[model samples]
Target: MADVFDQIEWNVQKIFDGEPVCVHVGNAMECELKRHPSYPKFHTEAVRAGVQPASSSRLWESLIAMGRLSDLDGDCTWRLVILDCIIPSLRSVSARVSRDFRVDCEEIRSDMVATALEAWKDTATGVAPRNVRDRMVKAAFDAAFRQGKATSSERPMDDIEALSWQEPTAQDCKPRASSIIDVDDIRDADVAEQIRGERAGAMLQRWGCFDAVHSFHDEIRSGHRSGSAGQAVKTSRSRSLISNPNLYYYSSDLYPRHIGLSEAAGVMGIAESAAHRLIRTGQFPLPVARVGRSYKVSVRALMHFKDIPDAIIHVDDVENGALHARDAVP
Candidate 1:
């Protein structure tokens, strides 16, 4: 006796049982293509002949749409057909990503299938009707990748190597308007030693000390480097001050350059849990940075995303920030 999977898959194959094949579904589905009013053109064809609905790329969309209708009507033959249609693609994706995601190939395949099934429920009224099967496979791969990472025993790396220029051309060797580099530049001096002492360039960037070290490099290579570096820093600061001059009223050492998740929630007049929900769905303008167990929202990105000319952000008090306004988004 065949298992349920086999039985369902055999039923899907039966749809192609006519013409070059044989009649399996009989007159159950019209020989004339199914034109669903709620569905798009990608989901239908004017004439259905000499083509396998599941085998032909031009015809698969229509088949999937029809299958959805069948599923809703209490006959689940289309659900099986949809799974059979995407299995090969799922196999290929699971094979390619299993190693990177550190999950067994079969496990990855199972996860992908589960994701596909969940996504399947939305096919009838999904945002986009085109490229249904292809998107399903991609969605499955993404879901599997996330699940693999969450379950994997491995931890993320803390350090990353600095990027190096490859095969420098004459144009690359030419000095830029910013800073000059010498053979015996900061590479052989205190700057190099300090840089080496830091965990990694990536870590240094995260700690916000990258610029100070970079300024030292400029100072060493260009004897008057401090002038240029200071001017550049001042120019950047001036841009922000154009709208809000009191940005640095509180000492930089005392305050962080981000809005705490709780503070952001208070500003938005929503509960923290509600704020989290909005953040998860990307309904908020600011991109959230997860630091350990807490979240940090950058003030600059928040301001830019909301298109507000002036706002007090990254401050200790939410009442003094743009986040305090209920109209942050409109």
Candidate 2:
């Protein structure tokens, strides 16, 4: 059996190493850089281990979002600067920076870190805004997705036939505007059409009116005659094609059911006499008690008597009768 100290160390080591690769969890692979006082030893060790330091842009956003960078305290900024300076030496391998992803990877000077942080604090509330930029970017992405231009090759662009740069003149510089249009008028027309259809459907199903009920039944039975004619149009256009060709019939109405939970509990202890009394009475404070799968006569008696100094109780039977017996302890 492992000693208590050995068990503690084992648990601690497991937390640091994380679950094995077989777990396939996202956060499992992410590792953090360790801070040290000596630069030479730290740099050499980090480089040898191929530990890459996180970039400033990503780190800044993360810290801000986690509320750690709020108020931009001088001490906190200094720590960040130290981490930033050591990052290049710790990085696994260098790669060419692209124009789209380029960030000024300048190593933050230790002396200036405090001043920069203080200046940032003075300028703003030291709080980063709730990322409206990300929301806007996602909206643009969704728009692209809806337009069927998500993939690079599927994007619509005019071919060689539309080229007109050679004949361009000052006349094209004039501002061109379209004719007057009422956006609300278009919405109103669509709303009116939907309302009219709904009202017609309701009138056909009206109660206390024999003609209306008969009309409703007739419409319901006649629906099958229309067959696939009323299905949604699904045709490939010039640049984009309809992805999902399956026609989904509209559901008229639906009501969903709700789910609830029941509370339950299990009890275990060592005193054979006490365990027997409780099992017989079923008087444990825990409201919903059940005999657990792991419950064993010997194990329960030993566990219950563990609280007492010198009492020794041993159970031999593995069956449920012994487990739930009137004299069984824990």
- What is the alpha-carbon lDDT of model 1 when measured against the actual structure? 0.44
TM-score of 1: 0.37
RMSD of each: 17.6, 30.3
Instruction: Please give the TM-score that candidate 2 achieves against the real structure.
Output: 0.15
Determine the backbone clash count of candidate 1.
Answer: 1
Top TM-score prediction, candidate number: 1
Q: Each candidate: how many clashes?
A: 1, 6
Taking all chains together, each candidate's TM-score versus the true structure is: 0.37, 0.15
On a 0 to 100 scale, what is the lDDT of residue 90 in model 2? 19
Please give the CA lDDT of all the candidate structures. 0.44, 0.26
Off by over 4 Å in 1: 1-58, 126-128, 156-330
Candidate 1 lDDT over residue span 164-247, tens digit each: 112446533543321132212354433332232232332334334555645554453344434222221221233321233232
Candidate 2 lDDT tens digits, 138-250: 22222222222222222121111011012325633333211122222446543322332232222222212334333433443344314212333233322122122332122
